[model samples]
Structure formats: C-alpha cells, structure tokens
Target: MRRDSVLQIQHSFTGPDQGTKGTLYLVPTPIGNLEDMTFRAVNTLKTVDVILAEDTRNTQKLLNHFDITTGQMSYHQHNSQSRIPQIIEMLEAGQNIAQVSDAGMPAISDPGFELVQAAIAANLTVVPLPGANAALTGLIASGLSTDQFAFIGFLPRKKSEKKAFLDNLVNFPYTMMFYESPFRLGQTLEDCQSAFGPDRQVVVVRELTKKFEEITRGSLADLVAHFDENKTIKGEICFYIAGNDDPSTDESLLQAALDDMPIKEQVQWWETHESMSTKDAIKQVAKQTGINKREVYAKYHEI
Candidate 1:
C-alpha cells in the first residue's frame, strides 16, 4: 500500500509555501457588466495556466472580450465527475488553475463546489477572490436591512419540498435572499406570498447590472399582482424578503397562522366570539387570507 500520499501533507497556513501546490483560485467574473471585472481578476485570469469554466463558450467570449487566452476546460454539473480528477491531477503537478462560473461568484448558486471540496481534501491551495455577487448587489439596492441577512441561494424545485423550504423560513428575523428564475417568478412570488403573507415587504431584482436592470420593492401581494397583470419578466433574479422582526411582517405571520388553524376552530371562533353568521365568517376569512370564499365555505361546512 503506497500510503505516503500528498493528502498527508499538513497545510502551511503561514507562508510562501502555502499556495504553491496545484492552486485553485475561485475567480469571480462580471455578472452583467464587463467593467465589474477587477484589475486583479483580469491579471489572475491572464496568468492562470488553466480556467475551469461552467460554460466554456461563455468563458471564451469573456476571454475574447479581454483578450485573455488562458485555455478553458468545461467544468460543469454534467462534466464534473470526469473533469474533477483531471483538474486535481493537474493541480497536484503544480499547475495554477482558476475556476469561474458564467457570471458572478462561482459556487454560490453556480458550479465549483465539488472541485473546491476535492482540492481542500487533497490539501491543495484554494484561494477565493471577491468581486460581483448578486445577493449582496440586490441587498444593497433592495433598500432592505443589510445588517443581518441569510442567503437561501436557490429553492427546491419540487412543490412540497419548496413549500417546506419556505415554511422553514417563515419566521426568520433577518433579511432573506434568494436566486430564482424569471420563468418561475410569478409562481415563486405566489408561493412566497402564501408562506410569508401578502403584506410582507419584498424586493425582486432582475437582470442585475445589465441593460434591463430592474429593482421593484413592495409588498408580496403587489408584486404578485404586477407579475400576474404584466405576464412579462426576464433575466437573472435575486429576491429579497423582509425578516419577521418588522411589525407588519409579524402581523402577516399572525394572519397566516390563523389561516392555518382548523376550519372548525376558525368557524367556531368567528361565530361564537364575534357573533358572525357562517357565511359572513367564511367571507371574512376569505377576504382576510385571500383564499377563495367558496373554498373556505366548503372546508367550513365539511367540518
């Protein structure tokens, strides 16, 4: 057994030898605007021996734009399984590599996590350079509280899983950020309204730093209405929903909790406490929670 492996080498955190191995520099590229690329980033990309890009074609365009000719090797979800070991081997031989996503920071909702993990496990040097980030970009312009926030990169695709995911954050007290597709914007806004309530303040930023850059801030209800009416939205998206600490947010949660109550309990409370007629109680709940009056009545009658 050749157990004298390179993985056994202790990481030298203090010196010139720290990153001498096959170093993986996590380089951040421009999300939308080309000017966002930093001078250091440009130089690094030019100097690196190889670039592991999420999309070689897109990276090639960027390279062509800046005239940086470092070779690009496709390293995306489908190709990672085969490419990782090859990249790792190259790194082990002291080849400096840079990993980049199509835009923004790699691995934050993009590819590169697996490569980073493998490099770390093998005791290789992994360096990250900060540049454009959609979440932080959206947050700064969101006019929302930036003091405390959570980055919920992307939500689950499945309905049940997505609902459970949003439900889990129903009471989060910090500003919450998310990356979602323009295609699902309407449905996502509706789901968020269902989970966080109509009154919760939310900011939806799309096509960030690009020509169609849009930043709309309002209650979840209003945004839903806007999207439903327009039926047209495009480009990258970063959604910011206000935390549970806000008074309005708290009220929305309380209303949502009441909506979650058993129909029988709700009917009894409305009928007995407020002396409201059955139809009136159903109408009130439907009005307050935005559920269909017929659905509320059916559920109430069933109970």
Candidate 2:
C-alpha cells in the first residue's frame, strides 16, 4: 500500500517548493463572456505544466482567444474514473496542473469533484480561483432572497419524477436556484407551479452575460403563462424560486400528517384546509402520495 503524507495545511501565499508535490488549481472559466476570466486564472493557466479540460475542443476556443499555449488532456464525466489516478500521479511527480470545466467553476455540477477528491486523498494541495457562476450571477440580480440559498443543479428529466422530486422540496425555506435546458423550460415551469403553487415568486435568467441576456421576474403562474405564450425559450438558464416562509402552514408537514389517513380522507383534507376544488384536491393527493390520479379519483368517489 502507498503511504500518503499527513494532512498538510495550505496557505494561499505559501510559495511552491521544488521538492514538494505540485498543486492542483481549480480554475473557473467564463460562463459566457470571455472578459469574466480573471487575471490570476490566466496567469495560472499560462504557468501550469498542463491543463485538464472537460472538453478539449470547446476549451480550445477559449485558449485560442486568450492566446494560452498550454497543452490539454481530456478529463470529463465519461473518463474521470480512469483519468483521476493519472492526474494524481502527475501531481505527485511535481507537474502543476489546472482543471477547468467548459464553463463556470470546477466541481459545482461539473467534472472537478472526483479529481479534487482524489488529489486531496493523495495529500496534494488544491487551490481554487473564483470566476463566473451562472447560479450566483442570476441570484444577485434575481430580486430574490440571497441571504440563504440552495444550488440545486439540473433536475430529473421525466415529468412525474420531476414533480415528485420537487414535491420533496416544497417546504424548503431558503431560496432555491436551478439549471435547466431550454427544451424543458415550459414543463419545468408547470411542475414548479404545481409543487410550489402559482403565487410563489420566481425569476428566470437566460443567456446571462451575453448580448441577448434576459431576466424575467414574476409569480410562477405569470412566468408560466409568459413562456407558454412565447413557446420559443432559448439559451442557458438559471432560475430562482422564493422559499416557503410560512412554517405554520408547511404543506409537506401537513401531507406527512395526512399519510395516516385514508385516500378519501386525504383528498378531503386538502379540500377543507386548502380550499381546493374536488378535482384539484384529488390531483394534489395523488401527487403527494405517488398514487395514480385515476386510483385517487376512484377512491374519492367510492361509496
């Protein structure tokens, strides 16, 4: 077994030693605009022995734009497992390496986590440089609460699964941010409306930092209608939803309590407490319990 060094404390300003293992730099690339790239990031890339790019083809454009001549090795999701050991060996051999995703920060819903973990376990120093992040960029301008927020990356693809996944977070009190594709924007909005209710505030930011950047803010229902009418949503998206502030009326808790009741009783509970119509109440019950809507409807109507 290879014996690793004890946990070595890192100080950002501590200069590298010729005898020590090389540092792993987690550099953030611009999400859209190239100007967002930091001076330090550029210098680091220039100085590093090599770069581990998520997509060599995509990163080549950025490197070309910046006139960076560093060689790159592909390190993405498909190849991370195989690449990690090799990367650690490179670091061990005192070859400084910088890891960059195609855009934004490394390891935040990107390919850097496994590599970072491996580097740390091997007791090598890991350094991070701050740069563009779609979620943070959207949140500051979103007009939503930023004091506390959760970064929920891409969600489940299927409609029922998506709804069920969101249903679990309905009562989360901190602001929530998510990344989504343009193709599924409409259905995602619909699912948000069902899970979080129509009145909840939301902000949708598209094509951020680009010429066609747009930030739309309104209630869930309002944005749902707006996007539905437009029908041609495009660009990278980062969306924010207001969190549940009313713990007294925490719906998830209420639903959990209702779990003890019969299906008919659950439907009735939503109607009486939420002032929902019979059909709407039945749908709500079905969504919460993962029961088939038809089964819930039949149970509600049974004598």
Candidate 3:
C-alpha cells in the first residue's frame, strides 16, 4: 500500500507550463523606502492583468510612485474567503494576477495565504518575486545570531495568552523576530523580560529603510526601562530577541564529575551526589555531559 501510494504521487514544477491556467505572482512591495522596490516586482505588477492588494488605497500609492497602471482588487482578512474562489476562477480563465500587501511580502502576516493556497490547489503556476522584508532587513542589522532564526509575527493581544505563548519559547534555541506596533512596544518588552529573563539580549528596529530609521539593542530589562522612560516610540517595529544559548544549563544540576566516568555511572553519580530522582538524574547527567537523554536512559537501564 505504501509503495502504491508513493508511485501515485505527483509533483508540481514552478517553472513548467500548466496549459491554460494563468500564473499567480506573489509580488513583494517595499516595506518603507520606495527605492527598495525591485525592478522585477514593478515589471510583474505592470504586466499582470490585475493586482490583488491588501489595501487598494495603500497599494495605489506604491503603484502611483512606480507609474504602474494595473487595476487593483481588494483582498484582505475580512473578505479572503469570498474572494479566493473568484481569484482561482480568474487564474483558471488565464488572467494573470499579482498579489501585493501594503508592505513587504504578501501572506507574511496577511490573508494572501488563502489565495495562494487556492491557486496551488487549482494547479496554477505560483511565482514569488522577492523584495524588501522588514524581518530580514532588521534581522541582518539586529546584531543577533543569524545562523538559525524564527519569524514569530505578532503575539496575541490578550496579556495572559501572549505570556503563555512566549513561555513556550523560553528555551527555543533560534533567534526570534516579531512584528509589533509602537503602542504595544513597552508592554511587550516587559513581557519578554518576564518570559526570557531580564538579561536576555533584544534588538528593537524601527522604520527600516526610512528617513527616521532607528535600531536599539540591549538586555530585555534595559529595553523595558528605556521604553518606560521614553514613553513614545513611533513607526513600524521588528523586535529581535536572542534565544537561550545554553538551554540545558541549570544551576541546580552543576556538580563535579569524574573524567572517565561511564554514561550509566554518570547518571548514578548525579543521583547519588546531587540527591536527584532516577529520572531527574538521567536528565541532569544528559545535560551536564552533553549526552542524549534517551541514550543515557537506555545505558542506565542496561538496555
């Protein structure tokens, strides 16, 4: 059954022709500075039969600046369900459409995802044209580790819900980026301090590629204090927080160990010396000695 299922699988190629189906171009608009708009994005927008915009008025300003004369249709969170079927129909009718958000990439925090999913399900050619993105722009300049990162766009509005959400990522080992409003910056900083601790490094990037762009870096506590004192922070923001570098480190688990101790002996030593339970000793020994917990458990059990 597995072999038969694998044999029946089909692959969709991005560049290949899909008969009469029209292409859905995921065009990215500049987050801030108009100069950051890519040439390809402009050309695609200009040539497409129609443009699906998050806000036609906001996107109009961008279109006007680029002298793009393409017509726009509103596709936002509220109307996405009603609009997706129509969009898929247009694509099926071979009318090339371009989707754009107010800023940055469409679908990053927007309802453009539904339309994209509809297009793909209809076997339409979906092409993405990269341009300015606030998260990546701020991340590169954030002074945080870029090797591995997660884009956690906007937390829940409710304080309790937001705190619980952040609590889950306390030991997350990748740099995290978040989009935030200037109004909530202070409160959010306070929350970060509580979840990740006061000493966790954070960078607050405001108004990227704009005339009044600002990048502030400090510990979560310092940022909380700074925002409290300043009382006014304007423009769009990208919040970058450093992840737990040594997530395994626990002060209570620290103890002297014999250099040549076996994995099982190490677990036993932690149990005897630190007065920990069998389960806890295995966990602590795994952390202290950089061994996998399951491997330590198996060794200790003589499995």
Higher-lDDT candidate of 1 and 3: 3
Give one digit per residue, the lDDT tens place, for model 3 in 81-129. 9999998898889899999999998889999888877776666778888
Q: Is candidate 2 or candidate 3 better by lDDT?
A: 2
Ranking by lDDT: 2, 3, 1
Best by lDDT: 2
Off by over 4 Å in 2: 1-8, 12-19, 248-303
Per residue, candidate 2 scores C-alpha lDDT tens digits across 153-225 of: 8999877889889998887999999999998888899999999999999999999999999999999999999
Give the candidate order by descending TM-score: 2, 3, 1
Candidate 3 local distance difference test against the native: 0.88
lDDT tens readout by residue for model 1, 72-156: 8888888888988999999888899999999999877655988888988877888899899988998999999999999998899
Q: What are the runs in model 3 whose C-alpha is more than 4 Å off?
A: 1-19, 249-303
Which pairs in model 1 have colliding backbones?
A: none
TM-score of 3: 0.79
Candidate 2, which ten residues in sequence have the lowest lDDT sum? 10-19
Clashes of each: 0, 0, 0
